[model samples]
Target: MESLLLSHSAFIPSQNKEVGYLGRKLQSSFYGNMVSNNFALRSNINSANRSVMISSVFGIGRKVKKVKKETVIPEPDYRIPIVLLGWSGGLIYADNLAAAVPIGLLGLLLLVQTTRVRFVFDDEALEVKVGEQLEESGENVFVGGKNRWKYSSFVNWELWWPNFPILVYFKETQTRPEGQVHFFPVIFNGKQLYDVMVERCGPSKTSAPKES
Candidate 1:
């Protein structure tokens, strides 16, 4: 799971920003209620993954003083997607790691010069914060940059390689290099996030990938 930590672009932790654009949008909000949520997550993670799940999921969460965020889970399966900015080059998916090495390294240098990403959410949009997040575990730090994806702007999406899942939250306005797309992997308490998605955004639709 940590194999792609470099590639997993997501937010550190945030809540103050919600008072910006998202606050206005929450007026006509969708989720006005709460219910019991208990999802059956994959329980067989190794110790390393278990540690990650604990730290990222419960170590500390985005602090929202007035606004209510869902309960935090010490462990969950579906990690919220972040804004991956590398994982690109002129290479295609390969039959083995040997052929992919040089190509992966070529574009990965761009990542070294950049800060990691993280996730935030409001009634209207999913926020992926970018830039350097220095300080103690991102608890009180503010991310200097971010990306936005409004719920309505989204039409469909695909999650790549479940082993190291990549969120492709297709939107009407997306136009970036696929290389950058692979890094921002978001983590979340799966059940809570799903409940919000279903209620506010409506039920999710699923499909099989098209064969070319």
Candidate 2:
């Protein structure tokens, strides 16, 4: 009976040792799994933060829109008509009545036209309109027949006597496919006219008229 009791006691200690070892192994495995899950979660959060920072700094995935502004047309200028009247007066002073009569009449006509006519430049075309309200002028008296001309149709343009501009000449295919030439006295501000022409129709082929 004493020998049997000793064997039983030894067996009980071995069983307890096995149970403690198994419990420790299970705890270690559970802790390892938790650490792995935490590491993965932190990595995902850091990746998301980096993506947001990059988008803010570099303007990625953002659309930029452009706003177009309206073009402002210049006011009428009377330099041409004033010069014509002055010339006519000079001729009368010189006692040249024959030349003075025609010259003075032309000056008067131009002065009247200058008061009513205005050159309106839009984004794509140049228009000749009359009065304070800017009503469209009827068909042109000269060739081309129309009062409006698109910048794209202009084949060439010139400002006569650049220093003291007198006439503006431009040829366009808008009226005729073969190209029609039109001439106008520079009744508008020369600088403004030249600037608008260059901007809308591109640079002129010739800046000044050729000497005869």
Candidate 3:
């Protein structure tokens, strides 16, 4: 009986140790799985946040607005032609027929051209077109000439006799690779033309006269 009791006590202690070891192993496994799951969840959240930030930044950049410039067209003027015709008449009255006849014809031609030609100043370019309705861009007198010229292509420009502008002259590389010079009688409003030229082409060497 004594021997049997001792054996039973030894068996009880061995079984208890086995049970404790199993419980400790199970607890460690549960904690390790929890820690791994938590780390994975955090990693996923960080990735989503990073994606949202990048998208938002790009979205804000795309939302920026651009302002559009308005087109400016100068009013038609016939002052140059009228002045020429009057001067021709004065010369004829003075009996200077040699110069008067040619000057009178030139004045008449300019008068006709004044009725047809139009200068259009748009946001990006200056366009010379013909007709009362501005429907026709007449054929360029020079070979390889273009009716339209961008302000950016202008090398230099001038309003001759700024106080009483009689001519408009500009040199540009748009028509020819080497360069091209153009001269036009100032048939448009001088003040309007000067303003637009200054605004679009930049400041000129001659300053505009102060307003009275």
Best by TM-score: 3
TM-score quality measure for candidate 2: 0.65
Q: Report the lDDT tens digits of candidate 3 across residue range 153-184.
A: 88778887666778888877888878788899
For all candidates in order, the CA lDDT equals 0.41, 0.82, 0.82
In the range 92-173, model 1's lDDT, one tens digit per residue, is 4435456455545633532442234334456566555444442123222332223555666555544343344333343323
User: lDDT value for candidate 3?
Assistant: 0.82
Name the 10 consecutive residues with the lowest summed lDDT in model 2.
203-212
Candidate 1 Cα misplacement greater than 4 A, ranges? 1-101, 106-115, 132-146, 161-164, 173-200, 208-212
Looking at model 3, report the run of 10 residues with the lowest lDDT sum: 203-212
TM-score (C-alpha, index-matched) for candidate 3: 0.72
Candidate 3, which segments miss by more than 4 Å at Cα? Answer: 1-60, 63-66, 205-212
In order of appearance, the predictions have TM-scores of 0.32, 0.65, 0.72
How many clashing residue pairs appear in each of the predictions shown?
Answer: 23, 0, 0
Q: How far is candidate 3 from the true structure (C-alpha RMSD, Å)?
A: 4.3
